[model samples]
Target chain A: MNSQNVFMGENLQELTVHGKKEFPIQYYADELFRLPGCQFPLHWHTEIEFFAARGGSIKAQIGRLEFLLEEGDGVFVNSNVLHSFSQLRPEDRCRCPNVVFSGELIAPADHLIYQKYIGPLLSSRQLPCVILKPSIPWQNSILSCLDRLFSLMQKHALKEERRPLPLLSFDSPADDIPCWEMQVQNELNRIWQLLISHAGEIPPVNIEKGEASLQIRMQKMLAFIRSHYASPVSLDEIAASASISKSEASRCFQAYMNQPPVSYLLDFRLEKAKQLLSSTPDTVEEISRKCGFRSSGYFCRIFKRRTGASPNQYRRETT
Target chain B: MNSQNVFMGENLQELTVHGKKEFPIQYYADELFRLPGCQFPLHWHTEIEFFAARGGSIKAQIGRLEFLLEEGDGVFVNSNVLHSFSQLRPEDRCRCPNVVFSGELIAPADHLIYQKYIGPLLSSRQLPCVILKPSIPWQNSILSCLDRLFSLMQKHALKEERRPLPLLSFDSPADDIPCWEMQVQNELNRIWQLLISHAGEIPPVNIEKGEASLQIRMQKMLAFIRSHYASPVSLDEIAASASISKSEASRCFQAYMNQPPVSYLLDFRLEKAKQLLSSTPDTVEEISRKCGFRSSGYFCRIFKRRTGASPNQYRRETT
Candidate 1:
């Protein structure tokens, strides 16, 4: 009944069903300007996501690859892919109109549209995300459909103007639902048609059998770091969480993330510290310790090196 | 050697080869503002075309279907599809950055990308043209690639800035050819990837055996009408051109074009008359007779009804 922000924490995004147990589509149009650091923390969802950049350049990280999308650009993140977004420029706010929907919206398991097109794309390991830029013909066609859908959904939301925006919860339609729902479905199907046609062209990255397992291991390590970032964590401890040797963990992180486990851990802590510095009224020393920094002096040094501002200065400026 | 506009006449465009035998690709970037009525007449090319609307709304007709593309909108006209471009609003001159490249540019017939992706698309009877609106995600991506290619090609072309403009004849060897040609090829391949991914989604319009034959008949009728529209033509004479009965020809026209055979002929004649009126110094009587109208009075009445202008008025306004 109400628009709920699905907190995507891990790899498998458990989509929140609205009315029925089987319904699997969720639409969220959120302004990243309102979020801390204007970013969504790295997470993956089971539902495919269509993220359109309304304004400013948005940086999107899908799996291990990252893309900088300018205004009017969009990216389609395939299901169960690790992805996140941040404003390219910190000062400029970005709004992403997103549609996270299950593949079932277009076709059932037996349908030709699904078996022929949607199945291959959702199952592709190589195509983690497709960046939609306005200059390319097919990509532009998909974006056009998305823009229309976003505008229609936005208009409908504005008309209701409820306290908590109504989650697109398509199954339980209120009596006063806007007539544009059919248009939204049509546009989505059009996008699916485009996706299916070009799905094969996305060269399948020869993901060796070991690569998937390694990705899962790296994912586990990431989850561990996320859960225990506030505690003093070591490379060995992170490796132990995934039942791998420290060197293997280091190698896995380097292979997938282009960073060592320790560096990723430190960066995660710094991000958490930055969030705390802006959101909480805690003193710099307390915040540093809370974010797993050994000392406020060391945290300040790393924070400035990463964010171009000291803890006090960042807090002051943001506040 | 020199920038040449490949005069696309009728349906099967026998591409004009320049400087070499069997040149596979021909590229032209032409501004329609300087041309009379700011439009390119109905024609089709064997090579695929990526037309990006630079400014204003451009109206494109592919086969019997028409689409209005706004600035920043692009359309991909599939190989050998009868298509034409015109300024949607005659007063507003539209600049189209066009790339007419053969399928060979991306992959040879024996190559996997061509065999798997390009071959099916070029040979598909169902897909005539794909209109790339900037709002669609995948299409937007292709358009983005095209825009970059156009800019790069434009920059390269500008360096020479010679009279008659140079055709993007890729076979010739120049010191700087490799640099920009590689960029062009890269961008085109990028476009192909987006295209091949989405091409399958365009459902094969179940085209029954009867329907496919009818389409071929209709295409032949169209070609015949195009060649013979200038002279006094009758429904029987047009029908004979495609070796079909008069009633069958009428039925085919109604089915495919949604108009009667005579009505289509009259409309085609009127279009010719309009072109002659604006482009030449011919009198209304002379142009009407040349375009197959029985009388100037009848031509004036039909022209006014279709275009909301008398022959002299239309000429004055356009000129």
Candidate 2:
């Protein structure tokens, strides 16, 4: 938080531009919104950050490049890179649970296991950044470890802050906390034990059954539109496939799929047309026919309006 | 590319995997496919992978979860995460240019600079997994470094792979070809130069201007649909804001955006209704009105069709 140290142990605390937190480990979880949206602006400090967006989208700009992030995706930004986040839409926004403990907060480098794996990976890449999407089988273990790390940090925080408390025993002062580091180490052991336990068994199915049903419907709809969109197909036709009425189809389409029947059909057609345009090097007229567009001029207008570039321009730029 | 040990030396003289190449150093750039429509199976390896989706949509399933990746979005799947990828649409698939080199491939760990930063972060967190989205300013640099790494890898591959007929030198028998390790080292130097030069600058903008325009339009369209879908918003209303004609708008909606106008609007409305139905303890009729559905019967039908479970069931399960 200060010039000498942007992040200091709360007991040996210092505060700065990132705002203030009195906790032992300044938890970034509750305060992530301060950065807002998904992208983070140019900024760097000595604190190590753990970022995970379980749902939604995130984009970060570090220098000139921008990196798009999706749910269950995250990256480790070494203290060296200046970075910032851009806000995302309400629908697109996601909650990324993370904790930031100063790099200097834990035991020295020699004691950590991450050094064996993460250490070499980071060093070999020569990249100031490391991005990660923990696989499902690894998610629980990873999250559990992080959760423990947070608790450990919290435990230490209490000791550092020396919060006043009444003692049960008549021995020693009530203000003193029992061995905090040992507790944290125990937490780390529990996390490791959980990870070892869940090493390879198939990951748990977390999406609800109803959500699964909706997902199935979405796939069916997508397949149907991809196959029959070019030819005339009505809402009723698609609905019949899902064994539902036209109106019912409309509601399902909106909630989980993000588009209704007719709209999805159009998307299928347009996407097909774009494929022809980008890969085949075909003319607008030719692509229109292949994509089920009736008129060449109409197709060109559509391509331009949607893509902000003519078919020809898109091909040229890409090729 | 070998498992046990990767040997890098002069191009010609190589045999055993672990056997060191005679020359000082050797660099090889393996050509990664740039297929826009190809899909890779779920897999993992010991080496670190840098994945970048240049265009369209790519969904990767690692562990138990699925991630929908767009352009410029990437995930670092550490070793042991079982993963697979699929192209949502033939045209929606794109190539990712990545550099794969071993920790032993570059400098020894002791001399690496990045090790200094990552060591502290990992040891401090004691986390089993960490995901990060770099802030702006840092993104560009990381991207540029990756870009340079890939470029150098390619150039090195060429030098190692191609050898012009050796000039007739009056030295020993023609079998003696001087080691190309020096050449590879030189190439690595060139890569380092590029990285150093661009280290202070923003990384390359991976998304094309045209692509950004389309994305911006998509963002606006999404906002419009979210805001006005409740009432009745025509195709004209959506297209007008994006500055396109109705038919053209349809194409835009279909293409990159992945849905048609009315259908998307309807879908959005229905989804809102579903959320309300599940979250709020409201009458079905009230929920229907809140979600823009006309009648309870219609809402029920749509909900049932989209979700095999009725609204009530969904609410119960969710609650």
Give the range where candidate 2 chain B is weakest over 10 consecutive residues by summed lDDT.
B3-12
Model 2 lDDT tens row, B1-319 = 2211111111211122321322222222211232212445323333334555454666665443466766555444433233445565664424455433332222223422224322222222122121212344444344444454444434443345562311211111211212222222223333333333333352332333354355345545655665565566778888887777888778766654346877766766665666676668998788877666767898899889876888888888877
lDDT of 1 by residue, B23-125 (tens): 2344455566655457675555567888877668887877666788898898888887766677877677556768776776554454434665677888777
Predictions in order: lDDT: 0.68, 0.47
- In terms of lDDT, the best-performing candidate is 1
Fraction of true A-B contacts recovered by candidate 1:
0.00
Error of 1 at A144 (Å): 1.5
RMSD of each: 19.6, 37.9
| lDDT of candidate 2 at residue A246, scale 0 to 100 | 87
Using TM-score, give the best candidate's number: 1
TM-scores of the candidates are 0.41, 0.24
